[model samples]
Target: MKRLALSALVALGLLAAAPAAWAHTELIGSDPANGASLPQPPTRLTLTFSEPVPAESATVTVTAPDGTAWTVGEVSASGATLAVPVTPGASPAGQYVVSWQVESLDGDFVSGKTTFTLAGAPPAPPAVTTSAAPATSAPPAATSSSVTPTGTAGPVATTSSTAGAVPAEEGGFPVWGWVVGALVVVAAGVALALRLRGRSG
Candidate 1:
């Protein structure tokens, strides 16, 4: 009778422990599978859990090798799957890390991390070219009106004659005054000869 009672107690204890073990959530699998190497980055990350997780209580973060966050938008929970979007072009060629936390069916929190490496180098950035502006020519200087042309003749200057000045010879005497002196000498000789003839008669 004691053996029968001990067996019943042992069965009840095992049953209670089984439910506690099954109620705990665990990360069973991932889309990029842990320790995976790929030629390119993925657009989204998916995590499979042993039990359904509440979307509001779940958080997933993806970090690049340079320690930059790559995850975007809200974490979505559908049945036993949790998914979050990631930027495809943001990460370079290197190892990436995914860290996640979720509330289990038993109201306990579970957190874990996984890592993956990218296979090749990231695509080279597009070449940048800058065009220089066209050179502008300065305007020509203005020409002055006071300047004379190279092959042209300048103006001639003239002086006006005086009103009452007489025209003189090279000796500084007038030609008309010399002629009148000669006429006066001839008249005096004629008058003296006429007086001598009257005295002889």
Candidate 2:
């Protein structure tokens, strides 16, 4: 009778411990809860689990609709909650998926995913304006004067403007020839006077 009682107590104790050993950590709730919609993106993602999680073994990834990563740094934990920093500038107005894996106190890793949507479209990118360059005008062509040639060969002669100048007739003797004849007449008169004086003496 005593042996049968001891076996029954041992069976009851094993049955009670089995459930606790088989249980694993599970996600309970999240901030920006699943299927939530917001006008703007959240700065951080918070996840709650059934038990405490370790920061070193927890992993969280936040991805945008276009497959761009939005998570910034390593995962952080506070008891049963985990917080992940998110980059709001990189996240546009679209659906975002959060995938998380955490190591529970029972040495089991639990993973799940949640999604949220942003309501309106993203703001338009800034406009790009280009300035037009100023136009340049070309310089004017140089002017040249034409020269008409005279028939003379070596060099063209120029007229002088001296006082008491004599102008030559079309067909006449030059002034220099008249002056030479007057000089010869005076010389002949002198020679005749000298010869008369000698004869009279």
Candidate 3:
């Protein structure tokens, strides 16, 4: 009977200590530290836990002062530490909130939030754009061309200067005067031949 009682006490002791060994995972510290005011924000965000946790059921969000999310993608968890990416241009000035939730190693879902301050983002340089005034090309120099004519001409009739003048005739006998002069010469020759024959007789 005493041997059974001793075994029962041993079992009881082990059952009591089991809860402490399987404790839930929890956030212990962070890279930015709790409520730290940063002059220059960190390149990567980090979260430390009391025990190892899986990344599948984990979620972390870093919110800026203007309520915009600064985390880029899914967070990575290895061992008891979780690492999150800080988006390149997401960080801004003023107060920021770092909210988180993760499944503990014991399968417990835990969630919490913390805040920090940023000094303000650097001012961006002004953009300067200048157009080239549409490239004044002098409007092609206003070309001028001269063209000469070619080909042959048609026939043209020409007349003498005296064609329109009237023919001048004495006593109005232009054609008949030549015929009368020939007949007078013939009659005088006949009369002289008869006078010569009479003198010889």
Please tell me which predicted candidate would have the highest lDDT against the true structure: 1
- For candidate 3, lDDT tens digit of each residue in 21-93? 6777778999888799898877677889988888878888888887777755778988889998877456667
The models' CA-based lDDT, in order, is 0.86, 0.85, 0.80
lDDT of 1 by residue, 1-201 (tens): 999999999999999999777677999999999999988898889999988999899988888888888746688989999988887547678899999999998788999999899887757999999999999988988954454557759634445689997757786667887889989989988999999989999
- lDDT tens digits, residue span 80-166, model 2: 998888776565678988898988667988899999998887679999999889888789778654444687455544556799978
Clashing pairs in 1: none
Worst 10 residues of 1 by lDDT: 143-152
Clashes of each: 0, 0, 0
Candidate 1, position 11, lDDT: 97
RMSD of 2: 10.3
Off by over 4 Å in 2: 122-201
Give model 3's TM-score versus the native structure. Answer: 0.53
Q: Indicate the residue-level lDDT of 131 in model 3.
A: 72
Clashes of 3: 0
